[model samples]
Target: MVELQAATKLDAVFHALGDATRRHMLRDLAGGERSVGELAAPFEISLAAASKHIKALERAGLVRRTVAGRKHLCRLEARPLEGAHEWLGFYKQFWSGRLDILESLLRQEDAAKSQGEDHD
Candidate 1:
């Protein structure tokens, strides 16, 4: 089991996802475990750069790497993802309220436009 870090795991997850390459790497890892070379092939960056991104993901607890013979295989660890879910859940009410307001305003505007067109 992954021990919860001092800083919220959500912080780690978001921090790890801040980079485009890392996010892509996660997407790839979702399918199955991959070697460093397979992960690096999709990006324009060098292998070293991709390795750095993988390192960040590793620190965040979003990825796990194991040595299989000579190759390092990367696997996605979803435990930290739960932290991300918890953090996002906090904003759900706010977004829902704002969306409701916007929807009402749009409906009002549409109603007004329809009535105006009827008068013409």
Candidate 2:
């Protein structure tokens, strides 16, 4: 049951990350907390649309929102991304190993080809 819940949350986090706008918003927050308007300034999106993006990030635990008078400030909450990072790290290692093997094989092939050319 706990595993299932974790998987669900991971799904939500990926879903939130799947959008470019939300990803950029997270990048902006990484610098520091920003008001919704500040976040929206880089794009031509309406505040409502920006809020919707932010709400998705909130649901994924990627961003925390605090009310400051008229401003809705959002700060980056990166802990949830630890799961995603771990997941990607696994694949990164896998691919790195595969690429290393491929590089070695290619180098061997090139060495053989050079030797053959030297004989001719």
Candidate 3:
């Protein structure tokens, strides 16, 4: 049950990250907290569209928004990214190990071929 919940959250995180605009927003927020207008400034998007992207990040636990008078200040939450990183890290390690083994096998094959040539 807990794993399922985690997977669902990860899905949201990946979905949020899947958009280039959202990724740029995340990158901007990484510098510091920014108002919705500030976040929208770099892209040719209206405040409503920017709000929608921020909402997606919020749903994914990637960004936290706080109301300050008329301004909505958004800051990067970043904890959810840790879960995503861990999930990707597992596959990274798996692929790295597999590649290492393949390289070793290729090196051994090359050595055998060299020895055969020398003997001939």
Task: State which candidate has the highest TM-score.
Answer: 2
Tens digits of lDDT, candidate 2, 55-90: 999999999999978989999999999999998999
Q: Best lDDT goes to which candidate? A: 3
The 10 consecutive residues of candidate 1 with the worst lDDT sum are 1-10
What C-alpha root-mean-square deviation, in Å, does candidate 1 show against the real structure?
A: 3.3
CA shift at 29, candidate 1, in angstroms?
0.3
Q: Per-residue lDDT tens digits of candidate 1, residues 1-120?
A: 254553556677899999988999999999999999999999898878888999999989999999989898999998888878777887998899999999999999999999999999
- What candidate 3 gets wrong by more than 4 Å, as runs, is none
TM agreement with the true structure for every prediction: 0.81, 0.95, 0.91
Give the 10-residue window scoring lowest on summed lDDT in candidate 3.
78-87
Off by over 4 Å in 2: none
lDDT of each: 0.89, 0.97, 0.98
Q: After superposition, how far is residue 61 of candidate 2 from its true place, in Å?
A: 0.3
> Candidate 3 on 80-116: residue-level lDDT in tens?
9999999999999999999999999999999999999
